[model samples]
Target: MHLDPAIDGFARYLATERGFSVNTVRAYCADLCGLATFAEERAVGTVDGLTLELLRDWLWEGTQAGLARATIARRSASARGFTAWLTRDGVLPSDPAVRLRSPKPGRTLPRVINRTQMQDLLDKLEVAASTGDPGAVRNLAIIELLYASALRVSELVGLDVGDVDLSRLTVRVTGKGDNERVVPFGVPAQTAIVRYLQAARPALAAADPGATRSGTKPSGSALFLGSHRQRLGVRAVYRLVAALLESMPGTGPAGPHALRHTAATHLLDGGADLRAVQEMLGHASLGTTQIYTHVSAERLQQSYRLAHPRA
Candidate 1:
């Protein structure tokens, strides 16, 4: 089979059969597309023409081009998956990428905000929110919920009004691969959310008078809204978190995930159980959640260096 048709079939299989997320499928397709272009440049156009040597050379070229190790590792996985699928579908006699390998991505500690800095940030936001600006109020609520629940931006924006139980102080989040989990938040987050719902949301919703007149609520039951009263998007949440973190002291990426990392590290620092934190984070693996333990240990070491008297 031609590589193009085989790649398309593999992508469809990932989406419809494997139930991969849209972003995951897109990444897989992108890697394979790159491989296809590489193969075509080398005059290899069919699935059968994809050799183990060719796969290694493609990854080598990516390394030479200075692509991140993570990107190369992902591309290797994509090629392996594609070749395995081709073999299974009788398009190839054997998988050429069976022995394909890429360098393991280095692990770096996620950026965490110190408790004092976090407190000061929240205080400033609360003060701004007191002015009753709809955007300000909503921003406070968004940040509060993000810190309290450690939610991914996609999960945060995907929330609906019915997904939140203000009385129970919990939210139903649909995470990666459409997995659903109810995460709990504290009293402060509850207060912020209640304020947003009662004050900010209604005002933001009313900003689009045409939606009300047309009898079509553009915002629908979305828990958050843009200024135009439409459902909030991932990019908007990113910009809000990025702007807030830009002035703060941090070395890692200034994005919503930083807030998530801070929340997890803070929870671990406060003696939260590892498995429980994993559940709250909606992380499928306890190993993934263990990174925050490392963060907490590093913080403890920093404090000890600063305060201890012994040489």
Candidate 2:
């Protein structure tokens, strides 16, 4: 079969058989398409004709093109997936990408804000909300809930009014893979959310009631609204967080995920159990959550060196 046709078949297999999400399918398809184009440029026309030499050359060309290590690694993984599937389905006698390897990228510890810095950021948000700006109130609620819940940007923006239970102080979040988890926040986030819902959300909703019917409810169900009173987008959230970080000092160029890392690390530093933090962050593996333990250990070492008398 032609390479393009085989690629399409594999994508369908991933979607139907493996039940991959649309984003995953699109990413895999893009990687495989790039590989197929590389192979075609090298005069290899069929899936069975792909060889290890061609695969290596493709990776080399990607490197030459200045692809980041992470991107190259993903492309290599895509090649392996395609070759393995072809061999398994009897389209090829062997997988050419079995031995293909990309350079391992260095694992930099995630950047987290210190406790004082976190307090300062929240203090600023509180001050902004106190100005009686409805948008400021909503922004404070957004930042508070983001840090408190350790939620991904998508999860935060995906929130609906019904997803939160102010009485219970819990939020029902649909995380990655559509997994549902109820997470709790403290009084600060609760206070901010309450203020936003009561004082800010009404003004936001009134700005664009969004296609209402006589005696029927308005269509604005999103918890966060854009200027157009539409659901807040991920980029807008990113821009807001970035702009907030610009006024704060002594922090890296980290985005909303930094807040998540900081929140998780702070939980661990405050003597919260590791496994509990893992569940709260919605991480599937406890191993992934163990990074915060390292963060805690480093902090402990710093304190010990500063306070201990022994040389």
Candidate 3:
């Protein structure tokens, strides 16, 4: 009947039964703990003491404290999910958060690089790759594959040496929820990847001579290695992409995911099937893939405004 035990059980359920990613499970746990703190303040010591009113009051308090709408909505969702789990697990006779509602967060358009700007960016990388510097070659390969395949940064870093099929010009990536898919890259990406694998990778692996004697060569089965010869972290990828996008015009995030948005938007702009992009991106829902269409339309309107002179 303890709240902590129930929370622990729910966390396990999310991780084991629901197959949620580690970060997602952590967020759910943290949100639920916030609710527990509120409940304890009201002298409610167990899961059974939760009520719909209490849940609403918690959200109201957040609003009074000037919490962002997104945070309040996420907390509401956490409560609903946790209470529903309790009812199903017989911790409660009925769900208390069945009617919980929260304010919707505003949706902003994703930043997308137009074809011309994208080309100009790659032109710079292409020039750098001509130097045959291992870092330059690897950077060219990473950005090319990222733009071509619309891969998440995690999937790009998570790739193994054998995951890439050079002959087929495809890379096998594991997306969210461990959904695996083989996505084809264009000839440019294929060329960069081939060069990196053949020359740059060996050069990087050998860069750390101490790894041979220390046996610390493989910190992970990562396709992309940091200067330390370890798996490249997502923060490093964010830093890399952010620096490249420092001068680019955009509103939303400037991380590696912006490359993903650009790839999907470009595919839609080039008349690719919506469903095909969905499959390639490994999105579980078709609606999630439709954002690119909106981006494409916004681009079209801008192009028309700039080029049309009838007004």
Candidate 4:
């Protein structure tokens, strides 16, 4: 089989048998495709022809090309997974990547927005909405929901009209791995959503008014709509959040995920149970959630250093 065909088959196997997420499958494909390209340039034709020396050469080439350590490490992991799979399936006699190694990547903590900055952003959003612009209302709702529910940008944009229950102040979000969770928001988010539904959605729908809607018909069933009245995409949500942060003072180089980190940290700061915060953040491991405790502890230390006189 051609390399591309074999790679396609392996991707299908990952999706169906291993149940990897789409993002993971794409990363695996990109990594293996790079290797295939390198092999093709050297006239290598089959998986069995792969060797540890060839893998090392590939890593050296990547380093020569100035790829970051994180990228090189991920590529090594991808190669190892593919070679192990091929060996297990009898496509390769041995796993050449078992001996391949890459440099370790530095651990970077997630960026989090402070509570005052978050509140300032929300206050600015509210002021923008009072200008009678419907888009302002929609933006306000998006920001509020993001910070309130600690949603991934994908989860936020994937929301449909029925996913929100304003009366109960809960939103049903489809998280990573397609797992669905109902997360509650505070009154601010609920209020923002209500205003958007009442004032903004109709204006947004009216601008397009495509075959997708009418006086009724639930306004096309998307909770967030683009200017063209289609489902809002992840990129749009990202740009909106980035623009909001750019206009704020004392904000760091944070994105929508920063809002999520801020929400999770604040929940822990407010005495929410660690496991409950984990569930709300859709983290598969409590260890991931426990990082917020470290953030909280650092904040407490800063407070003590500023308040105490005796050192």
lDDT of 4: 0.86
The deviation in Å at residue 112 for candidate 1 is 0.5
Clashing residue pairs in candidate 1 (N, C-alpha, C atoms within 3 angstroms): none
How badly does each model clash, as a count of residue pairs? 0, 0, 0, 0
lDDT string, candidate 2, 45-151, tens digits = 88978989888888899899998898888888888999999999999998888999998754567878889988988998899999989889999999999999899
Q: 145 in model 1: Cα distance from truth in Å? A: 0.6
List model 3 lDDT by residue over 228-255, tens digit each: 7777778888898898899987677889
lDDT agreement with native, every candidate: 0.92, 0.86, 0.88, 0.86
- Give the C-alpha lDDT of model 1: 0.92
Q: Give one digit per residue, the lDDT tens place, for model 4 in 27-86.
A: 999988999999889887678767898888888899899999989999899888888988
Evaluated at residue 123, the lDDT of candidate 4 is 93
Model 4 TM-score, all chains together? 0.88
Per-residue lDDT tens digits of candidate 1, residues 12-78? 9998888888889999999999999999999999888999999999999999999999899999999
Of models 2 and 3, which has the larger TM-score?
A: 3
The residue pairs in collision within model 4 are none
